[model samples]
Target: MDHVVVEPDSSSFSRVARALDDEASGEQWRAELATDLHAALELGVATVRGSLMGMATGGLDDGHEPLRQAVSASVESQVRMSGRGAGARIRARKITLRNFVNAPKRLNSRRGWRHPVHGDTETWVTQIGAPGWFDDPLRRLHARLHSAAARALDNRARRIARRG
Candidate 1:
């Protein structure tokens, strides 16, 4: 009778076990991943804010400088991550301009309105603003925001998976 024997590979098992058992390394890895995610969010928010600022300030009546500034200043973003999932929220923080909390909405939808000419009796003119000021930039940048987040996760995964 002939007999055959096989030996189990120990090196691979040991490496995997070491990696799993190193709690400090695991925690550090998690912290780095969170930092990377946060950095990505910051970058996305900055990009969106710049785009919003450009859109808010451009191609308007040029009469509502304060409104433009306020809208531009109101751009804000938040990132939330949990055991289940992660999310990013981009918005215009409520700004009270003329006691209007929805100033950004008003600016985005405002059409021509009757305005009295300065020092001119019985004379009035219509002032108009370019509509979709707020929504247009966000719509245009949606793809960019998604891609940025995906790239961040991909990069971190690649770095973690890199072998010596």
Candidate 2:
């Protein structure tokens, strides 16, 4: 025969159980999470934009100033959530940087380009620029962005607890 048993203390358990059973509280939590997540995404976008601006100017030739200006002017972000509450997933709305950076000339700047020397002579001269201009910063900042989103959710949980 086994006699040992384990259970949550009644007061704490009932408080949590009641909160979970309340539909309004669930909705409130989801709304707050969405808000927090959006803020985090905006922060991430701004940070990446700043980095991209620096990379564009510092790595590219002065002739590419337009690219730097475009980055500063055009970088933007949006966040969207799908599914309900607990199952919900937040994602950045599709980025439109492609429209600005995917053009034939821009793509060469992004991926790095070599010039035809002396009117298509046998020599090739590569230009100086930050290759992987768009992806490198994002890839570098991926961990920081994830932590920011997680911190927002953690803050949301703390906020809900305080309200409860």
Candidate 3:
């Protein structure tokens, strides 16, 4: 496991910094600038990750069209916000929506780890994004989805046994 360090620059912190700058007051700005920026970046990345995960896996289990639509709507809204909030200038985009458009593409295409023996069996651990953005959330989502699938299968087997 490679330790992927997220080294953001002044450009990436500019927008959120400005926003927090205007809103933050006195000690909040003075004492915790670094901490505030870190928290904001974490939160911003979390939002982006959540949006991507929802879009990528929302329909997986039951192929729920409504859930997919909701996720689509959410991402579209984020894209729209990215367009309006700071256009391409949002500092958070570097860790958040920098490649927002490309994320779904990578999730579908490059992210699969196919079973060696069972070619059709694969997991969605996204081979996407820089260190902070895609891989971490993708791995977490894969684990969560795998766990959910196992639980569903277990319930199904129990039902079958009961029927038998």
Q: Please state every model's RMSD to the true fold in angstroms.
A: 8.0, 7.2, 24.4
lDDT of 3: 0.38
Q: lDDT scores for all predictions?
A: 0.61, 0.55, 0.38
Candidate 2 lDDT over residue span 39-119, tens digit each: 666755666556555663424343433655554445444444454434223222232342333332343254555555534
Cα lDDT of model 1 by residue, 138-160, tens digit: 67777876787778778765664
Q: TM-score winner between 1 and 3, please give it.
A: 1
Ranking by TM-score: 1, 2, 3
TM-score of 2: 0.48
Ranking under lDDT, best-scoring first? 1, 2, 3
Stretches of candidate 2 off by over 4 Å are 1-5, 21-25, 50-130, 161-164
Compare the candidates by TM-score and give the number of the best one.
Answer: 1
Each candidate structure's count of clashing pairs: 0, 0, 0
